[model samples]
Target: MKKYFNRFPHAVRGITYATGNDFGFRTQVYLGLVVAFIVFAIYSPLSLFEFLFILLGWFLILITELQNSALEIALDQLHPELHDSIGRSKDMAAGAVLLAGLFLTIVLIALLLSRLI
Candidate 1:
């Protein structure tokens, strides 16, 4: 299990490939946003639960993006040519991430509103 866990760096390397090759600048921008929000949530008036939500949501986004990258790589390896099935699979993974993000947004809004009211 330790060996298996150690392999995660390689898996993350796959994600790094996407950031470095495809959208290095955009990836940096998102990273910056995540860091900024984390800092603000921790040091500002944000509740501990709010910080937890942000961190959990951030993790979900990262993992889903990594999974999508892995799927794309495996699909390319199996078939270099474009295919609808592969596209659908990737889209489905992205959709799941979007759904989670929507929930996270709602949680943040609700938590903040409850505090205010």
Candidate 2:
């Protein structure tokens, strides 16, 4: 158990690096944090499913951002020169992030409507 807990700092460092290096990742984190604060603090009487859904939505966004940023960084390192294929790969990764954000937004909206109803 003690050995398992030692990896947290590495994860934190990764977060720091990503936050510093990727503007889009940072923006997603900030917005996700706002929604997270609202859902966890202001929202009331969350069912298990709703809580899980919220967590999953946030996870999906973060996961995609990490993937997208990592791809861009690696690709840039591998081929610093501009190329059409590399640009297309980056664009598709970005598109994935956009789709994830839309899904998260839909989840948030559904939760809000549920609270109202």
Candidate 3:
């Protein structure tokens, strides 16, 4: 337990550095917060399931963004010079994040329409 607890500081430091220095990560976090606020405001009387779904969607987006940033940083450190394969890998990582965002958007829209109509 002591050994496990010792790693907490390093984990915290890594998260702090990544979120503080990464533009994409910060942007996604802000966007998620804004969306959460809008959804909660518009749908004040949310059911348990609806609220859970909203939280899940935002969590998925943030998870994907973190993964994308990690992959890009690792690739950059490994291959400072631009290469076709590296470019493809980065593109795929970005695509994954975009797909997650799109799915979240669809879910949000459905939720909003369900409430409005």
Worst lDDT window (10 residues) for model 3? 10-19
Distance from true location, Cα of 116 in model 3, Å: 2.9
lDDT of 3 by residue, 25-93 (tens): 889889989988887888888899988888888788778888889999999999999999999999999
Q: Write the per-residue lDDT of candidate 2 for residues 1-117, one digit (tens) a residue.
A: 877789888888888999987898898888888888878886776889988888888788888999999999999999999999999999999898889888878988998897889
Local distance difference test values of all predictions, in order? 0.69, 0.88, 0.87
Better of 1 and 3 by lDDT: 3
**Candidate 1 local lDDT, 53-107, one digit each (tens):** 8678666766666666667678889988878998888789778767766766776
Q: Report clash pairs, candidate 1.
A: none
Best by TM-score: 3
TM-score between candidate 3 and the true structure: 0.89
- Superposition error at 21 for model 3 (Å): 0.6
lDDT of 1: 0.69
**Pairwise TM-score winner, candidates 2 and 3:** 3
Give the residue spans of candidate 3 off by over 4 A: 1-3
